[model samples]
Target: MKKMTRYRILMLFSLMIVGITAHSEPYEGVKDIALRRFPWLAKALVFNVIPGIDGNEVFELSSVKGKVMVSASTASAAAEGLNWYLKYYCNRSMSHFGDNLNALAKLPEVGKKVRVVSPYSHRYALNYCTISYSMSFYTWKDWERELDWMALNGVNLMLAPVGMEGVWQNTLRKLGYNDQEIAGFIAGPAFGAWWLMGNLEGWGGPVSQSVIDQQVLLQQKIIKRMKQIGIEPVMHGFYGMIPSSLKNKQSIKVIDQGIWAGGFKRPDFLLPEDPYFDKVADIYYSEMKKLYGEDLHFFGGDPFHEGGSSEGADLAASGKHIQKVMQQNYPGATWVLQGWQQNPANGLLAGLNKDKTLVIELFGENTNNWEKRHGYEGTPFVWSNVSNFGEKNGIYGKLQRFADEVYRAKNSPYGSFLKGVGIIPEGIYNNPVAFDVMLELGWHVDHLDLKKWIGNYTKYRYGKSNVNVDKAWALFLETAYSSPEVNQEGPSESIFCARPAIDIKTVSSWGTRKRNYDVAKFEEAVRIFVTASKDFEGSETYQTDMIDFVRQVQANKADQVYASMIDAIKSKNAGNFKSSSAKFRQMILQQDSLLSTSKYFSVNRWLQQAINFAGTKSDKANALWNAKTQVLFWGPDNNPKTDLHDYAHKEWAGMLSSIYLRRWDAFIDREFAQITSGNVSEPDYFKMENEWVKTGELYTLKPLKKRERDGLVKRILANNQ
Candidate 1:
């Protein structure tokens, strides 16, 4: 019996050694595996999982060994480990893995080092930062970051859909629309945000010919770079949402979207059955071919996003008509639709060719309406997350839900429909951990060890791996990254457009107003964040993200102090008031200084601070008066003329008004006598409150209009007088 046991143990040890050698040795030296079955997956893997593997070497699956299967679990683990390793030794940033989803599908061959090459590469400088507008007009730095991220994560296919405006312009002109009318259909540079949001019309148009020309040139460059790195580009496709200029020139019944607030008219929806539809489609395709060439197979466009009306027509027929035009223009083209907010109407889907359609299940974890409604619906789909909105600063997501959803999708009856996973954040600069984790899902398909993954990520992000940082990350996973019950937008409220100097009376949808956060946990996170910040502070990526994290912690701490003052005031203890008032004043001043010191303070934070001070009701009417003045004077609406700025200002103004209303009502009930006796009189108090109320009402009724410069100047002088 002893001899038999010894023999068995020797056999087991030999097998273990063989397994380790088979799995690790194959991937040695070769570095990048450019898998052709899923070329995109290879790109994503290399770019995200192995930051330093950037060369031209296609890795075949036959060379992979051991348990090198693609699934959420495996991908997540690999990404986590890769992130830690890169940060620990390479001193390089990882890209959001793209295309690597394919690599996760099958096990690779044993005893070969796989170096996957994808079209995507990383830009060291483009660490996540607030975009002035949208990514439609990417700068060279933007392209570099995108490419770097691609190479880091191993993405071989990229969606370069810019320069379509020029394509559409030429298409419209050929179909008899005048330059002015065609230009009216195009949006301005700043309006890209709204256009991407699927919310507004081409407000700032007619687009400058110069801008159109620039975008055309830009797309050419983007495509060239992507091709060099082995990434296939997905260009823009036509889905019948044409400029209204086509209405008179073509025999088509136009579906007008009315005014897109701000007095801008939406593009007219061209009927698919219209004779001109065929002509326009041909023109559009010809121009696309002329500029981008006929090498592309994938195209993206959505008809009637948000709340588009499809009245007076058969929705199913309309969808079929649109697809027919696309097929006729570019045979075998893949159509991409954003499964966002009841879009790609059910009737529309009924008419699409299942094999040709690629549905993006945007906001999958947040809202599973798509999966629940059409899990077995046969069309190939990819899971995605819109974690951030308007790139607002805040932390909120369904982390576990991400893993859960991928698991459910993989095992569902429509499992075959689940093609892969992706990250579609409105802003990619904030919540690096969330972004990292989400991308990792593409490589994993089962239960993932999140702790190990986080450790790996910390090592890569910090450039030098440390156990202390690893422990800190573990704490972060438990605290900051821990799932919250509420639906918050991002990690912290953006102070860029916050109501200036307002006390947070109510939490925004993004969870910024909550004062009951665990300070001890946050403090732990701060220590880790500060440590990581120190190491990467010199790197541009670190400067953009880590410095911001430090400032956010400080601001959040100050917010807690402000929240305490409000609690004290509500306590109604004169003794507490006597002590708390001075402290509150000091804290408010300190917060103001801290806010000013930060170069990138969000408007939301500024507004919250002002509101908090006003809401305290300390120092009789002076506090309220100052709060009210600051809110009304420095409101986001006081910015330059631009649709993006206008939208921000309107939001800030509404928040300020809401805070003022709450305070005004409180004062009327608590200090009516002071007002009647003229002891607390401000010349414009009544007018300001009334005007604020009116503005808020307007925002509710319709989007806020840009305040005219002369009118604003007059109001300012009147308030002073």
Candidate 2:
């Protein structure tokens, strides 16, 4: 009996030690990513967790017995360390355009043990607009790929407001609201980002119940994946954005938030001080918990996004009450606020607990909101950049500015409150380099000189670097990716995608047609980049970039043609106008053909993805319409001259030939008539745009053969020079 008891005690003691050792292993999530993405290298890689110095996340890389060993404080850090080795040593990388994550013949040796400590605690990603612009049609497969990328890049916090449609539906229904009423409150999939931001109530939808249910399932999967990888999702939280019609049915003290941009009616705000506030907030969070889960820690909702009335309400007390309700439901939850164009008002800031609130400085590249607002009045803030807007196609990013601003913010007077860095691009699809550099900054304490940094970037990005490729990037940094101390919305707008106008000031509203960099330098870079085609013929990353650079040159040429046409119109040179306009039309056709060579630049991919996401034929049609309308004329339907038209413009293959070129044809013909004769005709573009969306044409990819694509690229580059 004594021997048996001693044996049991020893067994229990051994089991406890085993558990401790297992728990101390490097995060399994990071290991999972390695197995899934780089199976060839995974078997040779060992991961182990190490204590971080002074509560900061850190990663170490070393080689042990012919194996790559990664040690880190967290899963995100482990993933970053793995990526660091892949890029610096293996000369391989991944991006949205294409990944060069091919099987390695042998693992790269780490000659010296390398260690990196992250200064920032919170590395964030996504903008409200990013959900719609970049990922509206994403499926579980798409999201899985995205989450893997996010984890690898060390994104610990991400905005995930997808399943809120069901949450609101349940909350409103339980509060005695009918189905029809609930339908009116939920926006369509493409418009959910704006809807969540309290900009509009229902524009893209009267969404079907099944689709809403699908969103719930999708969000559950998303958050699950995010949590597994150590990323905390910023789920949509209740911030008094109720339907305006709720006032008629209930006794809540409602503040009407009149109209949003593009003529959509804004949702009403329930006064947080009202007795109904607690009850409605309770139902909202309860429904949220029932739909999502109980482990959520971060909540995102902005009241008065862009512009909305706060009339007859105590702003300070209202902020306090709103935050209190969130804490009551999810204890120790953080209220994530956007610092953009006078938001998180001083009155609002005065009432919140500084430790529990995080402000995202949305426009870090152009505006120093973090610095200007004195670190959001000394509240914890993350510096973020919105490099791309509306997913517009053009090569742009102030690469050095991103690194400079982040380092500056970290060392500034409010450095103590500067929590971390983030990539808040309204659209994430366009610039891979921008996102890559910005995210990597979180791992560094000092700023990186982009001139030196992009050399290693080119080596990894294209699998190997050539001298011509290196020279092209040097000019790329001087031109497209140059850091000019001027405020710009996004990449330079392509005049090819612009609405036809003799005096074109901008393409979409708030977007400039100005190629801020020297166009000749950019064209020269394109010419040099094309020279490496033979060397990198099998490289998808090189090919995609080549297509983009050539496309930008075509866009720049269109600008010249446009200038000539306008000059002819002004001087009554009808012959010159006719020739220039004809050239412009031909250029659009060629541009369409060039864009067709990649799925990334195909409008068919967008429409087909949307249609594929739906079940019923009617749902597919609705989804297709939503897809078309969003890219062409993001609308309120009644407003013809809506500023929102073409705001999400793509210089895509199908879009150019089918919609933009068609609209331009009508306008050009009208101009020709007015110039040749005394006839003044106007193209009703709004009607044309609406008709195009209803056409129900599902465009398909027509990728050109490599020989044909290369020839076309060569011809375009030669002609431009």
Residue-level lDDT of model 2, residues 425-448, one tens digit each, is 998877789999999999888778
lDDT of 1 at 97: 19
**lDDT string, candidate 1, 78-106, tens digits:** 33333332333334454321111212233
Would you estimate the TM-scores of all the predictions?
A: 0.66, 0.97
C-alpha lDDT score of every prediction, in listed order? 0.51, 0.89
Error of 1 at 122 (Å): 18
lDDT of 1: 0.51
Give the range of the ten consecutive residues with the poorest summed lDDT in model 2. 712-721
The worst-scoring run of ten residues by lDDT in candidate 1 lies at: 120-129
Q: Give the per-residue Cα lDDT of candidate 2 at 147.
A: 92
Candidate 2 backbone collisions, by pair: none
